[model samples]
Target: MKIRVSDLISRKERSKKIDYKFEIPKFEFEGDVITPVSKCEVSGVITSDKDIVIMKAKVTCTLEMNCSRCLDTFIYPIDIDIEERFANNNSLENEDVIIVLDDILDIAQVVESNIISSLPIQRLCKSDCKGLCQECGANLNKESCSCNNDDVDIRFDVLKGFFDNKEV
Candidate 1:
């Protein structure tokens, strides 16, 4: 959501608190589109200290994603704390700080960044997912397969013969 901070920038008040709710549509990342299962809410206070504006917010949302192991779809809840600093002056050399432009603060970019960064590296449907069987492409978590475990590929039989001829 784009918030116009012109009032906050011009006002004499040093600090202000604002609450916001937004519906973030599905966003694509790494060729995968993730959609939110519920509305996202953010509440925070903006404090001005000299020429710097500090914004602290808490964001909450539920998103739908596919499991990395089993490729199953599931819901994931996110609750993260966001802290950002905006500088009213341009002479600051810190690259981490955001520069306010036209007295506007577009919080949608911030929210998206936080949500993406907070996501787990590997998404799993369950804690102990057995994954798909390599032999017959069966789901190991569902049932047992008929493929034999002791069977070896015929291409490697020459190596097996060397082991059988060993004295040991």
Candidate 2:
């Protein structure tokens, strides 16, 4: 995931093509594990303008993730476009710029960070997932349940009591 940029910095090369494929280890986010099912593929180019180096790349990968609703495993595919800036001097250090050290750029962190941020907060197996029944702990998407789910909110208890005390 590291690329040599001495030629670009020295004005010897205007741009360099990048194509790499690598594996990523499983990592945990919140309480779920995100495991990569395929090799991460990155393809793009890095160009130099004055003292600044810009990298634009497209990354693709598939991950095994659990649905937050039904807790079922599903394949989550990712296709992201990334653009990053780098400089040889520390003066360019900021939110959008990375300082390249030792004439080499290590892009593994950048790629992983982009992938993690792109994940959905609530992963669902389908767009209309039925989730599970809170009363009987049964999967509503699979079968029907007889458990009573008519419970009312505690804030309405006073109204319920007033109606219960009335006589017809």
Candidate 3:
């Protein structure tokens, strides 16, 4: 995706309707692999106001990701709303607006960036997902393991024997 904004810049078209579907490869983010399972669909409008071009679009896609706790593969649906500003002329300030190069708006990078930003920091399959057990490497959500999890410090052994003799 690249869209030509010359029509808007030339004042021939006030707005441009964009409807496109594209594919993206797997992305490595935060030590996790995000694989796109569906085509990314972007639908929105680009409007020109004076020398500034504004693009508002909704991006949608399904991604295959792993659960952070248990490392199980799962599908993660993503929907991102993007609003970007571009400057067609040199008179506008360059800090906030992306400068249009050769009258084209390359939206691939923008869409990809939005998708990456929208991902959750911690991906979970469920709210109460029981992760894997540390002792027997068992999936806690599936089965229980007889692993002794009560850890006591060696420095408290003298106190433990003293407390065991007291009835209170």
Candidate 4:
């Protein structure tokens, strides 16, 4: 997913467009699994300006995820538009810039960053999805647990018996 910026770096603008499809495998990040379905299609225009490369990308893909409530697998479609600026060699004094990449910027990396950025702050199957029960470990959405909510503490009874025996 690397694009050669030779033409863009020459300070000459070119009306070049290319279409590409890429597949991103399942990966784990910060204990969350990211499974992307199908290869993302990224088609865009790369324009060369004075000491800068202008890129406008339109990408489409699907993200596969499991419901935290019912543990069911689900897919979410993703479509995004990316506009970025890249600096040419010896164009700027400092390397640290708002630009994405200065040399042979990896398109895959760009797409990955975009996908990660677009992710939901919190993902749920539904708005009222009942999570799993703590005691019986049952999915409350499908069925209810038999455990009583007002159960008394059995440990306190054991302590009471121990205190009674000490009195004897």
Among these predicted structures, which one has the highest lDDT?
A: 2
TM-score, model 4 to reference: 0.73
Q: Lowest lDDT 10-mer window, candidate 4?
A: 93-102
Q: lDDT per residue, candidate 4, 1-168, as tens digits?
A: 676666556744464675879998787644569798878899998777666667788989998876766766678788999877666566463744335345676778877788778877666677788777768888888899987655458867556566556753
Task: Evaluate model 3: give its lDDT.
Answer: 0.85
The per-model lDDT (C-alpha) reads: 0.79, 0.86, 0.85, 0.73
Q: Is candidate 1 or candidate 2 better by lDDT?
A: 2
- Model 1 C-alpha lDDT per residue in residues 26-131, reported as the tens digit of each score: 9876666788999888889888776677889999999998877667778999999999888756775375678776667787777888899888888877899877
**Model 4 residue 155 distance off true place after TM-score fit, in angstroms:** 17
Task: Return the TM-score for candidate 2, rounded to 2 decimals.
Answer: 0.86
Question: How many clashing residue pairs, candidate 2?
Answer: 0
lDDT of 3 by residue, 1-168 (tens): 776766777776689888988998999999998899999999999898877889999999999999888888889999889999987666676558988878788888888888998899999978797888878888888788899865678888668778568886
Off by over 4 Å in 3: 89-91, 151-168
Itemize residue pairs with steric clashes in candidate 3: none
lDDT of 1: 0.79
Off by over 4 Å in 1: 93-95, 148-168
Per residue, candidate 2 scores C-alpha lDDT tens digits across 46-147 of 898877889999999999999899788889999999998888877767646788788778878778888999999999889998888898888888898998
**Model 3: C-alpha RMSD to truth?**
2.6
